[model samples]
Target: MDGILVGNRLIDAGEYELAIDAFTRAALDQGLSADVLAGMGSANLGLGRVHTAERLLRDALEKDETSPEIWNNLGVALLEKGEIAEAEQVLKRAYALDNGQSDSIRDNLRLVLAKTENSVYDEPQEQDYKLIRRGSSDYMIRTISD
Candidate 1:
């Protein structure tokens, strides 16, 4: 099987390390194509390496600007790293590229908008947090109120 397919499967299985290795092999074979970079980025994101994922996803975007999936993945990475404004913009692009057809992209966009709107709220003493994954690269953030 192709390394990109293998890497994506590994990511869906939540084997992030194996996915990274698969993506690395794919990158070596394909010379860092957008799909390979996106796969690597997704693996890193799954492993909680947000900064690395962001860089790889950005690279992927440079290689293929029209891919909504890449844009969505980058948005997720940015959101995880607390770059809310940029994430909102990235997700908006993804949503537009997809013509609002993808539920995952729509959900991510809504999550970013909610975060942007809620940023003005008074600080709570403490809040619970949740990381929700919709797909290999799609992430949704939720705050649990005490």
Candidate 2:
């Protein structure tokens, strides 16, 4: 199987370390392609290495700016790191690039909007914002009101 494909499968299975290794092998074999970089970033994000993930994702974006998946992944990393504003913009771009066809992107956008509103209002209530990972590279933020 292709290293990137294996890496993506490992990511879907939550084997982030294995995914990273797979992505690394893919990078070595493929000369640091955008897909390899994005796979590496996704694995890093799964491992909670936000800085590394952000850097790799940014690099991936530089290589291929038209990929909504990379933008969404970057947005998720930013959101997890509490960079809500940038997350919102990144997710917005992802949504636009996807033509609003992806539910995961839409959910992420909703999450960003909720976070932005929460920050803007400066009101602390009983709302739980949960970041839910969906499938291989999709994320959904569930808001539970208490």
Candidate 3:
């Protein structure tokens, strides 16, 4: 798991080369853990190697089709590659796998759907904390009632 952890950090740092190396090392050492393959797919996706990500994630799914996160990330990669229908299908599967995993998948789905939306909402309904633009400050300032 060390390599996977390290690869995650590398991915966050935008170091796709290093992330890919770490994920490949982990997968090589572990020999086809679906988890490892998922990591590889994530790493490849970060590098904009969407085709590789798709293939690796597909292979991982073959071994274990129950991982919500894998399906979610695969959808993101597919979305990035402009494979809209495939991405939507994968994201639906991710949502079906687990509700907790649905947020990110739904966010991606929303982004894609936004492209087809007739119009954007004028603004979010007022709440306790509304984003504001003042002369010199921008903050999530909230109102307190006594």
TM-score of each: 0.88, 0.89, 0.71
Candidate 1 residue lDDT tens string, 60-109 = 88999999888998988888777889999999999999999888889889
lDDT of 3 by residue, 109-146 (tens): 56545532423444422223221111111111112230
Candidate 2 runs further than 4 Å off: 124-131, 143-146
lDDT string for model 2 (1-146, tens) is 89999998998888999999998999888988889999999888878898999999999999999999899989998987778899999999999999999898998898789879978778744555555667666556666652
Which RMSD values do the candidates have, in order? 2.4, 2.3, 10.9
What would the TM-score be for candidate 1 when compared with the true structure?
A: 0.88
- Give the least accurate 10-residue stretch of model 1, judged by summed lDDT: 122-131
Off by over 4 Å in 1: 124-137, 140-146
- In terms of lDDT, model 3 sits at 0.64
- C-alpha RMSD (angstroms) for model 3: 10.9
lDDT of 1 at 104: 80
Which candidate should be chosen as best, given lDDT against the real structure? 2
Return the TM-score for candidate 3, rounded to 2 decimals.
0.71
